[model samples]
Target: MNRDPLPPLTAFPPVPFDAPGRTSPVAGAPTLSQLGDAARAMVPYLREQARNTELERRVSQKSTDMFREAGFFKLMQPARFGGYEYGFTAFIEIISELARGCASSAWGCSLGAIHQWAVSTFPEQAQQDVWGENPYAIMCGSYAPAGKAEKVDGGYTVQGEWHWASNVDNSEWALLGVVFPPNEDGTSPGAGFVLVPRKDWRIEDNWHVVGQAGTGSKTVAIDQPVFVPAHRRLTFAEASSNNPPGASVNTNPIYRIPFLSAVPVCLASPMLGNAQGAIEVFEELCGSRVTRGAVAGGGNRLSQFFPVQSRLAEAYASVDAARLLLYRDTTEVEKMAASHTIIDVPTRIRNRRDHAFSTRLCHQAVEGLFSSVGGAGLSLDQPLQRMWRDANMMARHISLNWDAVSSMVGQYHLGLEPKGQY
Candidate 1:
């Protein structure tokens, strides 16, 4: 673990676990543990339809309906709009549990459900515009600033093409990133995200991929420019600040955590679960697998092999370590946010470093078990093959890439400014 040189942030008071319930105006929200059980119960159904989900190139409507009915989407949403407003751990666990069933489903749920929390952190009127008519409305986002927006009277007109907007089929709104051209003073205009309704964006059916095929991560294009209200926009500078515009009205501690540092955890959580599921599937298959021999009667069980045992042990260790670190960092960050402590620069960088490292461990765990599996594991229809494909593709995400994280972390430790996006 990376150690921080700064003194502990102990001066600010810590918010009690029940603080949200006592302070929040809303009533009767379910606890985080209760929501975890709901997620765990849905695993079997998700697992049963994993292949079909990939075949259809999207999560089944049945699964989506089940998730909505179970209140999974509201885990991180604000209490005022019928959400539990739970801490980050609940969100991580919910996504991880769902990933154990299907990585693509978990990816879609994590991306879609997390947007609810993101939208809540926006201005009050923006939140109302999103959830007032329908509290359960789902949203999607593309963070790459593919559009150019002109600053107008009430808002900006945005037109951009965004790819990998996961689970767009289930979303009624989108948060698209755009870069401002320039200001009248000739200063650089920074990048910000704009909110648009589903009617303004069109989905392009272009999500065919080898791994995580069921995510429905299709392209979303805005051909005609759409006007966005200024209140609905959040700048990257605002996101990096301790006090955002929403902090004036959204008093929940859940919204206080640093976005750039904490959002990576959400992206990495599902991959960890996918790797663990791979190990579980490997163990189940290896138990009954008989080694090929000159004579059928002389064949030995694959589980008895020393190499197989070593691989299983190694994979387990890696996955367990990864999960422990994920939970540990999450709890620490949540505690800091609750206490109204400013997450210093060093701590934020450390969070980014550990998240990427954890993702690397998950990939290693999956690869170790995958390599030991026989040719039967290569079959397209095999569960092991599916896990391998999903895990491999997941490891390829920019945030999870080991090389980028290592460089950024090294630069920070050396007292040099890190270049990577937080």
Candidate 2:
């Protein structure tokens, strides 16, 4: 792990977690073991909604309501603000559990939760702006830095369009990337995602794609000169290192962890969850499904061939490895957060690479299951098939790209210059 000089821990004001039994459950939220059980609790309901979610091009309100009733959104938000403020490991486990039930729903919950972490990263004013209204108000964001903001007095005039705003229906706020013109007499501008009220923007209903369709990832446009109070914006440079605003207020070591880890972990955790869901499906099939003996099987597919058995083992192991990798990283984050220490750039880079690998491992595991399940896996009616397609679509996300993460991580390991855009 790369070690950066530790910044002195500062005395900050009271935060959400200070208030117990407010936002989170009495148990202080679920651990990895507990979160797995929560996911299992929803399996029947998720199976019922899986097809409906896909058919309607969005997750059903009923399914998400189940999440709400289960106190899902509060898992990541601050307790003062009605969140569990649980460790990242618990969050990942819960997300994986949700994905097993319905990948899209899990994606919504996991990706949507990032807004909670992101909020804690911004100015106290920004945090107040969000939680000051409804403590349970959850926000979802698309971190793609592809918008423009002209600097002004209070804040910048933000105007941009962003896609993949998942869980738009459930969130009242959104995070948009804006490149603001420099304050100095130079053309150099800064880039970062800014918090925008859902009311200030218009949904474009432009999310039409093959996979993860239930993500409801529509395009959002912020027209006119939108006033995004300065506090609502966090510069990428600050998040890059040395200036995370949350450390001043939140004081949690997890909150003090790297932004690189924050973003990719938010993105890939759901994918890992979804892959675990796929493994559950494969296991179910293994237990009971029969196969054609004339071609490759004897009775049930479990007794058919040793090759599939090997593939199933690989799939199981891949998921287990992915979970363990993520578990280890988040465990360290939780530990560091409690200690209130700063995680260095190289460690952040490793976390990023691990995040990317988490997705790849998920893909590989799903592929292992997909290849073995044969024709049954491709049936749209089969839940495994949905997971298969969903995993493939998720793999292509920019954050999870194989080549970039590997090259960046490898160079950092070799003591080469770090090159990362966003």
Candidate 3:
């Protein structure tokens, strides 16, 4: 059975349609956090292109350029490098804002921007190589265990096909995950993330999917065996313990955060954006639209119908609860990262729980919207249809699966000595 949480007691009132001081053209420029009405207004324009984006199977090159010119890619980048460095909470907030416009574009922006923060945690040499070419350089990622790495004299030889790399077409590089035999004894396989240049591999156009079609999440196959210097490979375990090589470069508190917490924020921010986008659709339909199989004046005001009202309240509450949880978790992550303290086990478990729950809430919220949507909502003009499909598709991503998260949390709570619970 689908269960929904009650709205937070201290929930902020919904954004007023006539909120004062809303600004526009959010660039010219600042981070997404500083966005005013100008930025908020652009969502409708982007939503209009949602169908086009879907048909093309990716965000348009023009849209990518628009994002770049608007400085959306640097949301999590370090300020010292002409980047935003707004931390996880602000990043989540901004991504959610963009997502209200176009979910795929929001996904791309969230993935690429969060990669900047992850890279900031790597060795300074690696960071230099990354931003050296262009301070605004964007990076897509594939952190799944799908590639192989060989221990060389200095660095490592990497070769494999990494799939589900979102926003690859607009990225300057990729951070691929690989496991290699230990150099000391070749005993245990070493797991880490390695940054690779676009020139090092070839992109395979194989990301055909039912949802998030515009993420352009293709695969990269490095047949030639690219050489990654030892500096580029960053192990999450070591990083969480303050053993990262880039510690000397960034020394900033933000770069020392735990991977389990920070990584999930990167993955979930887009969904947050997606939920906000769905809310926009819901508001429009619930206000101006009329329901079928209902009397006049009874359909336009959907609240008049008990069933419609129930679903509206249910979906809104789910979205509201999920947004609050996401904000709280991101705030905690930022605080811990600033202190350079490795998150304890309980905290990590809590984070995983929050992440899974966030996705579940958004998925259910979208489902509720679909249910409440009059038959007319099943059309291109209704962005809710797109958001609903996008939410269902992204919910399948392993990172957001509530079952897996519940399993991990359950083991921890049951004293079952779980492995990889975080």
Candidate 4:
């Protein structure tokens, strides 16, 4: 891809929302640390509703409302648009904190909040369309390029179905992936996402699963082609890089972060929380649980046993390591983005590799401690079982697959271009 010199970003003029001395409800523009505290505060409510959320097959409106009020949806949004304008590390930390309460809720909210960051990457007009009338409009997306669009006079006519569109039921807009027909020159056009309003399409309600059930990741279909303005479409090639078209206007350094590194970091960061949650639940249970039919002592406390002690120690170490990797890599990438230094292929590859590897560590830690939970943990009511399921399901995501990412990392080290998404 050829690079262009980015024009100096003309600052957005001060508007009513940009009052100089105004204090927000949370007091001024909330900091990332404050956002994290808010996320942590929601854990009890999220944990209490985990089962009900699964039964509904979507996150509850109350939870969504809590997140919205907590300034989570604005964490990475532009300051001119009532957002915090924080970086990737803040995003990861907030998401992980929420995941510890409920993986599905965390995943749902993460995608919704992240799309706000993504919308900031579109053309200024498109950004205005989304946030002008309503700055808090959260967006959900389906990244698979399953829809077909035909180029027209003003824009493209989009049609077809998209699957696993998480948080769609609650969102006002959607970022849907599409394949465009060939140009007049006969060369194939690039794949991209079409930003469609909720009115343009309908939900298909097909998300039925044993894990992450509350994410509401259902299929959304558009029966007939809807005319989407040119400004609404963003190509993958542009999105996967640091220099997207929206950067010309938005001009925030956080938006300059590479897509591959940014997306996987947010997607996989929740697993760290899931693992930590499982450990906490297990340790809590261990405090009260007693071993049955003990060989030496009759009905000794589970925590007193040597096996339990060793497993807890190992699991703690694994989870700690995973958290460290996520924070270290994301912070480094954020610094590079802020400094306007291009993140090289090696660093991007390492980010991808470590993300998957870290997720694997989380999965192993959760699963390893699961066996010690015994029959009590087998019940659907048990938080440990739910955490295990959530962690396992998270590991199955295409971006978090260990073998695929590891292969890409290996290939890169051998002087070959990464053969996998990176």
Candidate 5:
């Protein structure tokens, strides 16, 4: 598995995409293709580390450093902070490639990287609060609106135990979801995110799980009330709208798109990679696997069996179909954002629908492959079994859950008000 070494962090220029007053590419920015190649080059090493990553129940710091050095975390960060400011489409490609080697590592990377973009949607001061001194800072988030925020003089007092803050171990800051109190008029409460530095909260090591264990998705607890400045808070209404506060400063069209329209792709991309990786493993195994049959007189090549062949074909097709849906929807959203087109409800729901459906396809592909592997895949040593478990866990995510997203899509089509997150 010899391959070229990863490109150095210096190889990525401060601004890959065009900035506000600039028309030319940065002097030394690496092309998107180079970034993709770098991700591919790390696959073998990531695959070798998969077992240990799972055993430790967290992505290794070495892997996290590798991602930073390769400039993956800067892909969606604001160019002002020495980031590439690349779009979600590039994110999907890179994450999927990484997932082919290790789903958990890929999941950690995916969330960490996407939060860079998420942070960019906050006010400029909040963005600076995060990347002011540390341009390389990355954040992990729990978007469940589980925390309570009390309005104060210049900020809000926030406290709660937020669950499933993925990649918390490797993150320097956290984007915690909080529910603001009712308005003066006694309107409904508003739900949103408040940025809190790692010092303000504590990580409870309770992320023991059967799948995606390497993600380090533990609980973030603020036992006592912590004051979060108003500038660091982003309301859901503002974030879901086309124009968020960050849009005023960043001015990149990428920052102007609705939050939900593209964020879920972060969740789907790793599952897409997991399915693709599983298929590759299945192909390799079928080539050398020989069935030990008692009644059928053993020693038959597994590839020769029609059922195995059919399952392989089906898995491949499912993965391909899933990839198509993901790319098509992501590309459309990115294009719309670039053109300054408002991402209307129909388009938003369509993207959400594709996100869940794509992961569902990936789950089906992994399940089919796992079912065909028989007793061999049950071993802890087998990557196929891990892929199966990881894919199942990803599909169960609320954002990518078929039942949850599909029902929202159905409600929109039926002219009833949709009831779930967009």
Candidate 6:
């Protein structure tokens, strides 16, 4: 099939970065450092837009356009589709930097970008269906098996309401999760995703929340059954096996990575940024902040207090530790993929363990920082309070939740069959 040519690489607007050695030879292709610098450059603008984003309950179209122009969304997309095909480590750095400005915006961007890689795991026809005409089209997803699919002649009839599809407002398609019924032999195909275009599904506005409100993680519904071709479906088994159908075409080591080995990083990276941002805000405030003696201390600088100093150190340590774990696991997996090595179960589970643990560390970092902020940090105008709320929300995700992942890890170590996704 003849597809329309993509826009010239030079058509992407250049993002201003003052740092030296940040340029890329390829017009639209961004080096990791350049991408990180671009994300850092957007911080002030994102912070300025933070409150309004929360109030509006969605990342502004302007912000989305800026991200697209910067080439962040193409980081993990297949090179065939004009993506940079960067690894998960690069994704971690860019997303964490964005989260330092606004967790919700970073999250919306994270999901949007990650789905590009996810979609690349489907059959070649499915990949073409999505990006053939519009290579820039992005997808939003709801991964729980909340939808039903009935097998038909050439495809399946799908219907359900998928909840918490982040960045749905800006997406052209959705990956809705569904489970296929067992075959005549009673062998089950298990849970998987079905690709549906925006025309087939409707977005429901119901994303009210105290944290990460700007993400606009709403519900996607198909009231009537929609026919989804078989090629558009990717089973959990195929994706986890690290040799999905798209691997034959994309051939990128990134696409060969097991789904659980790295995808959870998408959930953890935002919290990592939230905590780091909180630490920065707290340190800046402590430098000149003098305590008012409502009870005892009046003139002492907040930074002078032993407790405040300790808290700052603790927060920094926690965030640093989380980043290292995330980077270590992600990079290791990428290297394994590059070597065409089979990612063993132990390695995969260990990565999952780090994903949850790293998120917990980030959450703790923000919590400790928020604790010292006292009444001053409680104000709605303060970004610390928002970061605290956002970190809490990020940790609550099922994939990043400490209790769930820890239990799964424990089950494996104890020789019992692990029950959770890995």
lDDT of 1 at 383: 79
The RMSD (Cα, Å) of candidate 5 is 6.2
What's the best-to-worst order under lDDT? 6, 5, 4, 1, 3, 2
Please give the CA lDDT of all the candidate structures: 0.80, 0.74, 0.75, 0.83, 0.88, 0.88
lDDT of 4: 0.83
Error of 2 at 214 (Å): 1.0
Superior by TM-score: candidate 2 or candidate 6:
6
What's the TM for model 6? 0.93
> How would you encode candidate 2's per-residue C-alpha lDDT over 1-422 as one tens digit per residue?
99999986321111212222122343556544554566679977877788888778776777777777677776667666766776566666567667777888788877667678778888888988888987767776877777888778888788778888888877889988778777778756478879998889988788777889888888888767688888888888777664488768865555666677655766687787778777778878877878865764456656357877788778767777776677677666555555655676766777887888878988998888888777767788889888888998888887888787788878878998967752
TM-score per candidate, in order? 0.91, 0.88, 0.88, 0.91, 0.93, 0.93
Q: Of 2 and 5, which scores higher on TM-score?
A: 5
355-418: candidate 3 lDDT, tens digit per residue: 8898999898788878876676788766788888899888888888888778888999999885
Off by over 4 Å in 5: 1-27, 185-189
Give the TM-score (vs. native) of candidate 3: 0.88
Instruction: Give the Cα error of residue 295 in candidate 5, in Å.
Output: 3.5
Query: Which lDDT tens digits does candidate 1 get at residues 102-190?
Result: 99998888887888878877888999999999899988888888888888988789987999888888889998889975777988559
lDDT of 6: 0.88
| Residue pairs with clashing backbones, model 5 | none
> How high a TM-score does candidate 5 get?
0.93
